[model samples]
Target: MKSNVGSVDRIIRILVGVVLIALAVTNVIGWWGWLGLIPLITGLVGFCPLYPMLGLSTCPLKKRQ
Candidate 1:
């Protein structure tokens, strides 16, 4: 899939994901923190389904081969 997440977006997602996971593991945010997996997965994969549904894309233009 073409990348839909930009560098800044990916960074934010990773940061948020890490925080959520930490909070969950430490029992500070409860099981709800598990939901962070959504951002984590999307960030790692660089493809966000919701972005397309919302007609949003932060990725840079790609050069044609």
Candidate 2:
């Protein structure tokens, strides 16, 4: 699939994911914090499944042939 995540969005996701994961690891939060892995993986891959389902995209469209 094409990348639907923009640079800024990717950065934010990574940051938030890291924070949440860290909190979970340090026991600052609950196991729920481990869910951060979702955003982390999506951000790293530059693709979001929900984006298409929700009709939202942070990426710029490429010109079609």
Every candidate's lDDT: 0.91, 0.96
Tens digits of per-residue lDDT for model 1, 1-65:
87999999998998898889889999998999988888888988999999988999999988999
Task: Please report the candidate that would top lDDT against the real structure.
Answer: 2
Model 2 reaches what TM-score against the true structure?
A: 0.91
Cα lDDT of model 2 by residue, 1-65, tens digit:
98999999999999999999999999989899999999999999999999999999999878999
Model 2 clashing residue pairs (backbone): none
Error of 1 at 63 (Å): 6.3
Candidate 1 pairs with clashing backbones: none
Error of 1 at 29 (Å): 1.0
Q: Candidate 2 at residue 4, lDDT?
A: 96
Highest-scoring model, TM-score: 2
